[model samples]
Each structure stands twice: as structure tokens, then as C-alpha cells.
Target: MSALLLDTAPLRSSPEYRRLWIGLTLAGVGSQLGVTAVALQVYELTRSSFAVGLVGLVSFVPLVVLGLYGGALVDAHDRRRVIVLSSAALLVASVLIAGQAWLDVGSVVLLLGLVALQSAAFAVNSPARTAIIPMLVPVEQLPAANALGTLSMNLGVTVGPLVGGLLVGTVGFGPAYTIDVVTLLVALVTVLSLPPLPPLGGARKAGLASVLEGLRLLRGWRNVRMTFLLDICAMVLSQPRALFPAVGAVLIGGGATTAGVLASSVAVGSVLASLVSGPLGRVHRHGVAIAVSVAAWGAAIVAFGLVLLLASPSAAHTGSVTSTAVPWASWHLWAACTALAAAGAADAVSSVFRQTVLQSAAPDWARGRLQGVFIVVVAGGPRLGDLVAGADADALGEALAAVVGGVACVLAVVVLMAWQRGFLRYDARDPVP
Candidate 1:
């Protein structure tokens, strides 16, 4: 547990934190539903892997464009209001999606476009949302607060897609989106009731100047820069999620249902890991924990690929008839689950430190901006991986793509950790701010 959480565990006893957690949890579920809707809908309509991949492309561009500005806006405005406004925007997009499905008017371009708008709205929401955490909980309890938040989020995300896949597969798209809208409204109403969180370090009059100013601070802070860079490489190199469906159908031979099960398993692993992280909270060292955690993540991914290899070599040999398709069976599917679960759990441990480092290292005045950039890499890296790995899935094969990403991630983490002497030496006792 980070100092923020352990010292402040008594504070989480407050009603406000409970409400905030509940609200965010419901909204997290809704958001995951919306995400799953886009991917599954796109794939269903176009039946093209590339079109499915474009979902990330659509979401990423707007999110990247609005991200820094959103951070500045969060710094410049009320955190609660920003979250409410952004949640409302997301609701509108959800309503729009529901309407599209209701009318039987489905255009992949239009769907992607609306999903992009929702992404933009969400882009505005996160910085304020993250910045609000310190206000809701004491600084000392922030890590525990964060740990709880992670548990809720992982639960929502894991269950959302599994339910969503079943819903989209059975109940139809209209209901899936409608559920998201209801959840968002709940989140909005819950946030509206919280006590006011004053702007950190007084509001900077909002402008590009503030954004650049935030950037300047992060640049000068060596620990923040180094940890974030390692995060980027770690995420970019080994994100094999885009290939899950393909792997389910081709490599594992269970199809979409299997994909959902496999996909949900990753989040299950993350949730289980976090739930059991009593020891992860006690670590005193930042650099060693982060480096080792991420390297474990990379190695787990490689282990995942190797499992695929061991499952069925004949999986790659396709026949025109479905009967001739080689069956990799479900045990390999279980192995993939084990590997991904380990990866998610390790990554979660890594996340606690990374967030701690960023908050401790950056001046509170500029934490939102640094977090905004952090959000960008956090969100953006997956999309980048989708493009890279999705294309590779077409050209090479899903198993091979997983292997490729795994190798790159291991090398990147080792090199980055070796070079970032500053991050390794950072002490939490003396906060950079």
C-alpha cells in the first residue's frame, strides 16, 4: 500500500468516499459496456478484422486531441462539474447508439463516429476524475482509495464485456446501450451530491499556457518522466488483447463465446490479484517493485504465447471446410487465461506504484496535467497495440503476433529500467512536490 492509503485508511470510513466509490463503480460498468459495444458491433457489422481494429483508431484520435486540454480544464475548473459534464456527454452518445439500433439504421462509419464523440467526452472526464481522488480521500489514504477503485473498476470491466457479449449475442444492441445510459445517470447523480473539491493550487486561468506550463514541470521532474516512459514501452510492446477473439476462434477453436470467457479471464485475474494484494501495499521501494513487476508482466505475455504454441501447431493450417479445422481444445484456452490473469495482476501492482510516483513526484498544482498525459499513454497505448497487433494478426497469425509483442515488451522494460537511474533512486519520504 502506498503511504497515501495506509495512513488514511480511517478516512475511507467517511460516507463521501463510499458514495464516490459506488458512483464510479456503476459508471465503470457502464463505460466497459460501451467499449464492448463498439468492438463487437463493429465486428458484427463489417465482419472485417481491420474494421474492428479501426474502432481503436476512431476512439484514440479524439481522445489524444482533447486530452491535454481536458487536464488544463480540470485544473482550471471544478472537479465535480467536469466529471458531471463529461458523464452527461457520454450519456448522450449512449442514447444516440441506442437510437441507431432501435431504428435498425446501422452504419459502421456512423457507429465509429459516435463512439469517437463519446471517447472525446470521456477524454474530458478522466483528469478531473483522477484529480478528485485526493480531495475525496486524505493524501495518505489515496493508495488504498485507489486500490479500492481499481478493484471496483476491474470488476466492472471484467463482467461488463462478458455480459455485453452475451447481451449483444442474445438481447440485441439496444439493451446493451440503454444499460450504459442508466449507469451513467447513476454516476452523474452520485457525483453531484459529493462535497465540493476546491481546485488544486488555486485555479490557473485556463489556457494553452497552463497546458504547456504543466508540460514544463513534468519535463523537469525526472522520476515522473522516467516512470511514464517505461509505462509507454511496457504497454505498447505487449498488448495482445486485440488478438483475443482471433485466438479464441482460430487458435483455441471455441469462437466468440470462448473469446468472451478468455477476455473476461484477464480482468478476473486482475481483480483476484488486487483483492489479494495485502503484501503489495507494504513495499518500501518504488524502482525495484515497478521494474520487476513490469518485467514479470512481459514474461507472462511470452508465457502466454508459448502456451499457444504448445496447444496446436495444426491450428494455423486452415481448410475450406470447418470440419477439417484443427482443434486446439480448451486446456490451451485455460493456459492463456492463466497467463493473462498473471499479467493483469502484476500490472495492477505496477500501477499502484506508478500512480504513487506520479502524485508524489509532481507538484500537486500540476498533477492533473501530468495525469492527463498519463491517461493519454494509459488509454492510447492499447489503441496503438490494436493497430500494430491487429494488422499482424492478419499478416502473420494471432499466436505469432502475441509472441512478437511479448519479445518486444521484455526487451523494452529491461533497457528502460537499466537506464532510469533517477526512477530507481526516488524516495517517497521526500516528495518532489
Candidate 2:
């Protein structure tokens, strides 16, 4: 039974992997704390949701450009050193955010600028970190390694916001930022302790040429390319999270707390999925697993939309009922949360397969650049989805928007599966990149 649970072989196999994982878990929680602080602080300063939205706009360009170039840098230099430098940059950004809060500076623009810089540094940091995982564990254990990484990330997302809220409410923003700084310093210590990981097959200087070469390789890898496409279809078409507020206001009728429950339900589902992901490590047909998981995600979204559309008219107008005050006996809210949880679980499965495939299929020489592109897609897809879902909700009610989006996502996956027949049959035992 333990063997059927999440595999701990990778942690047992390498002391370095254990240290890296521990440091990253701590740092991830801190990063989430900082993210919540920034959002709350921005709202406090500007008193506008649009200003908070600008955080994404400011961070997007730097993330893309730096993510691509940074991947090339990872391929060219010692990955350990690159990660160390990026960690330092992250620490500096945390300090600056804390300083601003402590000094009572009210410049939203400056705060956004620092956020953008932090994001750019993150783009560089993510690829190097991902590209290092395969180096730390054996080939057969790649799936377990990816699952562990996913577990840490999901844990951070699940717990960090609550911690941040508590800290900000009682202590303040300065303390939240200080906590982030401390976490980063601990993460840096782990990076410094790592053995040097210079690129294999001689160092190719990071330049436009190196970036292009990575792109060229990616373009030819059919299975890897399909993973990105499938993820985009699922995220861009079916992710209705940006509409949670509206759903809570008009459809679910629990107001802000209801919206928060809907948002957090996804994370709850994801964490649960990760906890029992032991069987996933042994599955070999990764491409099919990804496709099936995404289809499940779309189906869950469709069900969720239908639930909203079919609710009692009186239930929709019960706005006086706050989410916090609502009892667990509230069947309607539980149903909705259950749907979101199912969607989250399906998405987590897809993510694990995608990460495993990317790490295993790509060669050591080109892994960093491909991982960089993956980072950009992961970050940008939901932002784009928000725009699409928002516009659709405005034009056609939120319920209908969600339904249409889910249907579209399912159809897109069908088309991709048909077009990339090879991807569906791809075997982990004999990966081809």
C-alpha cells in the first residue's frame, strides 16, 4: 500500500535532492506570502482592481524575454551559479518591497516595477531549477521527482495565502516581506551547497544563436510540442477562475467568501491528487495520460457551469448569506466546490505527465530552453484565459461562458489528439524527442 502511494525513492536516493526540495518548499511558501502582500498593498494604495490587474501586464514582457534568454544562459553556464545569482536577485527584491512598506512609501508604480523585476528573475530561476531535477535523480525516477516538485508547489499555494492573511492582519506587510527574505536566504544556502552543474557537450555561449537553437529543437519535437498545445487548450479555453467573483455574486450568491472558497477548492483538489500520486510514477503512456486528464478537466468544467445554470433563482439572489457564515451543510455550495475540486484534480494529473515528459524526452543540452518556454506558457495561459472568460461572461452570462469554454476546450483536445496521433501513443520507456 505504501508503494501505491507517492514514491519517496528520490528523496531517499539523493541527499542533494532532499536539501533542494526542502529549501524550495520553504521558499515557495514565502513566495506565496509575498504575492498576497503585494496584491493587498496594491489595492490599499490604488483602491482599484484594474491597478492590481496591471501587475500581470507589467510582469509579462520581462517574463517572456528573460525566460527565453535565461534558458539559454542555463545551457551556457553552470546552472548552480545561475540559480544562486537569481536567488540573490529575488532576495534583493524582497528587501526592497519590505523597505517600501516600512518607509510608508505610497508609490504603486515603484511597487509594480519591483514586482516586474522579481518576475523576470523568477523566469530565469524556474528553468534552471527544473533542468536540474533530472540531474539529481535516476531516469526511472523522473516521474516521482516531478510529483514531489508539484507537491511542494501545491502545498505552498494552498497554505501561503492563509498565512499571509494572518500575518498582514495582525502584524503587517513589512513582516510578511521580511519572512519572504528569510525564506529566500535559506533557499540560497541550498543552492550554494549544490555541486557545480555546467552544461554537457561543451558550453555554448548564451546568445540569440543559442536561443534559436533551442527553439529549433523544440519545433521538431512533436510529442513535447503537443504537451504545450494540450495544456494551452485546457487552460486558455476552460479556466474560469477569473470569473469566480462574478459567479459568487450572481450565480453562487455567497459573495466574496464564496468566491474565495471556489478559488481555494482547486488547490485543495490539487494537493489531494498529489498526495496519492504514487501510481502515476509507474504509468508509461504519458501522452495519453495527459490527453485523458485534460478531457476530464473539461468535463468537470462543463459540469460546474451546468450546476450554476440550473440553480434555483432564489438561490442566485441570496447574497445576504456570506461564505464564512455558511454551514458545511449547505448542499449547493458543496456541490460547486466539489466540481471545482474535480477540475483541480484532473489538471494536476495533466501537469505531472507534462512535466515528466518534458524532462525525460528532451536531451540535456536543450532541456533548459524548453523548460523556459514551459514556464512562460504556464504563467501566461491563465492570464489570457482571464481575458477570454471575462469578455465571454460580459457578452453571454457567466454560466453560458463557462459552458461554451468547456465545450471548446474538449473539442480542441479532440482535434489535437487526432492530428498528433504519435503523441497519443508515445511511450515513456522509449521516448523520442
Best by TM-score: 1
Off by over 4 Å in 2: 37-53, 98-108, 165-178, 244-261, 306-332, 390-401
Overall lDDT per candidate, in order of appearance: 0.73, 0.79
lDDT per residue as tens, model 1, 73-192: 888887788888888898898889878877878798889889888889988887777777766666666556666766777888688777766666566778888888899888889888
What's the lDDT of the predicted structure labeled candidate 1?
Answer: 0.73
TM-score of each: 0.91, 0.87
RMSD of each: 3.6, 3.6
Candidate 1 residue spans exceeding 4 A from truth: 1-11, 310-329
Q: Candidate 1 clashing pairs?
A: 1-281, 1-282, 4-140, 4-141, 4-142, 5-140, 5-141
Q: After best superposition, candidate 2 residue 125: deviation in angstroms? A: 0.2
Could you tell me which 10 consecutive residues in candidate 1 have the lowest summed lDDT? 317-326
Residue 397 in model 2: lDDT: 69
